[model samples]
Target: MKRLTAAAGSNLPVGPYSQAVISGNLVFTAGQIPVIPGQHIQPETFEQQVRQTLRNLETVLQAAGSDFDHVVKVNGYLTDPAQLEPYNRVYAEMLGHAPPARTTVCVSLWGVALEIECIAEVIDHRLRV
Candidate 1:
């Protein structure tokens, strides 16, 4: 079992613990705020936050040698339940047809409007690509 962390762009150990962890061919990402590269964690709109949150997820997934298609499940935590529709729409657009199984919950985000975490199975890249 190996605990995952930001591999390239290292940041302070924020909040409770590490950013991500991987074990037994599965990678688990900690809750990621919409802290895009060169951008603040705080964003102006729900749409922006949602995009950034997904981007952040993609970033970590890339670190794990996985992509959105490799994600088997996802959990979205939104500061506002009303943002569900827009979130779903955008998420669908982002991942195209092979959308991973997902669930969205309304919760109070610590410092942002949206946060998301996910579990992905690392696929054999050579076999596929």
Candidate 2:
């Protein structure tokens, strides 16, 4: 097992935890919030927050040798049920078609609209040649 820190300029973990972990062929990412790396401000809109969160997730995934196409599971948390529609739209737009199995629920978050985490299969780029 290997632990990863902030990847591809993604935000550093707020607590004592790695951003992602790799074991064998799989990469497990910690939940990502909408805060931009090196910036404390978060996007004001739910849709914008969702997009930023996915961008952070993508950064960690790519660093772990994976991408959205390789994701197999996702767990999402939203502070409001009303944000679901916009969240879905942004999710589809960012994660692409045929998204992985996911579970999203309304929950209380500290000054954030949503959070997302994913499990993905790691790709060995050398094999592509």
Candidate 3:
């Protein structure tokens, strides 16, 4: 069987899935919503929720021993396509030049404001989750 490892674990997963899984040299993270762990924020603003979503993704990556710079690809799901501008600004600000190949589309959010998923390739061959 292939060994699978997780990055981070909050109180509980909103759905029946993992926050992230690591196999071989690749790490894949499940979509994250804007709702903060252990703290439910309702009527979350678009900008605020987007920032929080990235923050959550960052935490997962860190826990997996891989940072944003190691990310090779990202899939962004925005409830509204018009939000691309604002989300792009925020993502660029945080990600900087380490922009991974990303594809953003408008998808009805599962249960929250924003959702983000990513796959990263850690440069260091020494680390294998």
Ranking by TM-score: 2, 1, 3
Single out the weakest 10-residue window by summed lDDT for candidate 2.
120-129
**Model 1 whole-model lDDT (C-alpha atoms):** 0.74
Q: lDDT of each prediction vs. the true structure? A: 0.74, 0.88, 0.74
Off by over 4 Å in 2: 125-129
Prediction 2 global C-alpha lDDT: 0.88
RMSD after CA superposition, every candidate: 3.3, 2.6, 2.6
Off by over 4 Å in 1: 9-13, 124-129
Top candidate (lDDT): 2
Q: Which candidate number would show the highest TM-score if scored against the true structure?
A: 2
Q: Residue-wise lDDT of candidate 3 within 5-35, one digit each (tens)?
A: 3444442465567767777888788877776
Candidate 2 residue lDDT tens string, 1-129: 888877868887889999998888888999999998888889887788899999989999988889999999999999988899999899989775878999999999988889999999889553221
Model 3 misplaced stretches (Cα beyond 4 Å): 1-11, 123-129
Q: Quote each prediction's TM-score.
A: 0.85, 0.93, 0.84
Better of 1 and 3 by TM-score: 1
